[model samples]
Target: MAKELLKGNEAIAEAAIRSGLEAYFGYPITPQTELLEWLSRRMPELGRTFLQAESELAAINMVYGAACTGARVMTSSSSPGISLMMEGISYIAGTEIPVVLVDVMRGGPGLGNIAPAQGDYNQIVHGGGHGDFHPIVLAPASVQESIDLTVEAFDLADKYRAIVVVLIDGSIGQMMEPAELPPMQPIQKRNQEWAVTGAKDRERRILSSIYIDPEDEEVINFRLLERWNEIEANELRYKEYFMEDAELVVIGFGTAGRVALSAVRAARSEGIPVGLLRPITVSPFPYARIKEQTELACGMLVVEMNSGQMLQDVLAAVGGKIPVEFYGRMGGVVPLPDEILAEIRRLCYEPVAPSANPRISWMNRMNITKN
Candidate 1:
């Protein structure tokens, strides 16, 4: 297929369609409204199910119901909208149904602006839902990656009967880029043995998240943990840039990571031995890679659009073996490449002992007095 200039939200929507998405249920929210808008028109033309629910809560439950039928189902929303779906998400996780979710994150703990932000990292990566289940989270930095990961989300969701989340910030969702989408795939009839299809000649299959017996619930929890262990083992994905002989490493995801790549390149031009590690699978984080970098790299920098959410993960991976620094612009403030470049320059030339609290140091630098 020839490459075309495509908007990220629309590209992802079409990619899901081409991937044989059978049903979509979502309420329109900023940064991701285009996705639902595109599907509103395309899904009907393709004779697939498309619904605009009353709200995010309704939308997620609709997705949950559709997924139980073993259909390729999806939903998209922004940060606050995602929060509203947490209970439904937990239910889907407990039921062990396959569902794909796209989160075009914007700012805030509340009704923040529609600007791009990575604040949803902890909420989505760690569980916001009340449960003992973990969802597979994929972060994409570019529009092209957004399209590709949308397709991958469905496959992964089905393979393990798990929830797969494509977590991108608002910037990627609103950006435009030249990308090639996969050819349309024919929708395959689902024959999942565990699916709650009609029991015409065979015994009925019951799928529910509720287990009244405590021991039965414990067994379910164990099953979830074992599956999570397998996912962590096989699905960890990341991309390394200029790391062959890197002495300083930068870690970020989505737009922060993409911007950091530019900074790393700038630092390299100035003869700095710096590299970048962008995690594609955030849930199954690339801890092993970070651990390896600790052996070779003198120091590490973590950049994010939130207040050091991923920083904690990197610190755990480093295990205090090397100095770890953090830089962030929260509340929808996207950091510029030059800003990250400056941090890299400091890491390379003006080395300091790792602070007891990196966020405190960062706040001091930013002149924000923590009250």
Candidate 2:
């Protein structure tokens, strides 16, 4: 009830418990190890299930099993670990099981480092696993947001009978900040007639992704897309910061979005008409909202900790209506506010050679030296 200081991972784990999580199966990994560690003690004290699986694969399957029992379940890991769970995630989606997954992203196409990075954007949002399924991805920018989204992930998962991902970067997972914990939710088990509780009073309900007939599989795929359309139409979310009378809009999500806000404020003080557009829901991204801003602004700059993952999404959103540029910091390095501000200046005020890449690299060694 009272405000207290907590690390982002700890806050998220507590939020999951308060959100009526019945079971959590996770392996310890940097940036997200605290989440598993915290629950290891807390879950037993609360008489709920907590497990340290032999590997990420084992953990996700355990979550699959628990979710099939109509229980609110969760699991967490960092980048490489998450990759290992992709197969199970696909199976979970194929069966239409509701479960929450937390990804405190770190660097890499491989084991890059323990520092924060946003490289998982494509892998998480654009179907990391096989099949034409989409997971609801919520990117939180603060410790409080990490907690808030963790709570929301559970509700959304159950509401749609689909996987929900609470995506935060390594910085948020490792940093400490003040947060107000939500009130403890009363524990309640979900009622799914199809849950695999051994046949007792009712007839046995079958649950499987195997629709052997191609026609049956086609029907199920269409149904899934129909549901996705509903989510895309209804769940698009974003927050605008000082967009009125702005000529340039800076777009980012998760930790990068938070940094972009700082750059926006700095740009405005110098009379550069700049603002920020932060996406809250990464998947079913706010395309319509971004298109509206593109009409009003001269150009847009996309900021991220990856090469150009979300940049492509922004480009698609604008559809060549205005010039779009990109600035990034990869391999666990976070772009400084000034680095972002410099790029905004280039887009709004400075002139550059037309032959240059449309996407600018603001963090080059020369620029870093100047700064």
Candidate 3:
């Protein structure tokens, strides 16, 4: 493996290339526009079909059509653009076609802004469209993870006959870092026993989630639930540091998770007893492992770029066995190590609990502004 300096978006594009993605379809959106442009320029050199979709909706729908033909296809967009693709994503989900969608998130609710944000966590993990299905959402914190997960998403999606999403943000997508490229592999379509390439050559294969009978609907749900259970059992991935015998544990994901690790080191140096839990698989959520860790820790502090999405998961995981607290900066505000360390100090030194009188003093505001 040879290391090369690469931006996160470039790494993802290269990974798709090396993974032998059959086609690329996407519209330009901030934080991820370079991703599509990279494919547009590079795919042709390798004689792969790359389409600059007129809109996000069209891009995702084109992915849907290509996926029906059993092609390894992908599309990318930011938050608002992803919202536009939700209906089509629903269609893709119902059709149960394998595709990869990359979300380079930006501040949202509207035109928002071109900046790093993880506010899309809930929407991506919980199924944005109207349906009872979940997309396998992968959150990558670094260039290397982005490359590895991008390639892995295809394999996972193909195996499950479902969609795999690489949920990243501007910071990771745009940030330059060192990555080692994996050797390219030929992407021949596998399992004609299930693919719909040509019926004349084999039995007809239907790629869809539409079930009419009530019993069959239940059967489909059961099959999907079983697959999800397997996902929970084996696909969950996370990282922990300095957690043994710690009094307080900091939980976060993506770039926020990286900064929280630094804060854990700083708090440890200050004798504030701290550790970190960085979640890599946001979908499987690593709830059981988080619950086990909460058994020993005094408290769990969830740090996130969003208001408190991951915090709720932490609370549910711990089930009040330990005190759960939250600290966040929303709408693209990425918290720093010092800011996270301050929260750790409060959790370590202060006796604030869910029952403790909430300290809503004006001093807190002054301190935050001053800091």
Task: Please write out the lDDT profile of model 3 over residues 136-188, one tens digit for every residue.
Answer: 88888889999999989988998887778898989998999989978887878
Compared with the true structure, what per-residue lDDT tens digits does model 2 show for residues 270-362? Answer: 999998999999998998889998779888889999987898888888888888888888989999999899889888876544344455544
Question: Order the candidates by lDDT, highest first — what do you get?
Answer: 1, 2, 3
**For model 2, what is the C-alpha lDDT against the true structure?**
0.90
Model 1 pairs in collision: none
* C-alpha TM-scores of all predictions: 0.98, 0.96, 0.94
lDDT of 3: 0.84
Better of 1 and 3 by lDDT: 1
Q: After superposition, how far is residue 59 of candidate 3 from its true place, in Å?
A: 1.1
Alpha-carbon RMSD of each model: 1.5, 2.0, 2.3
Candidate 3 residue pairs in backbone clash: none
The reply for model 1, stretches above 4 Å from the true place, is: 368-371
Off by over 4 Å in 2: 351-357, 360-371
Clashes of 3: 0
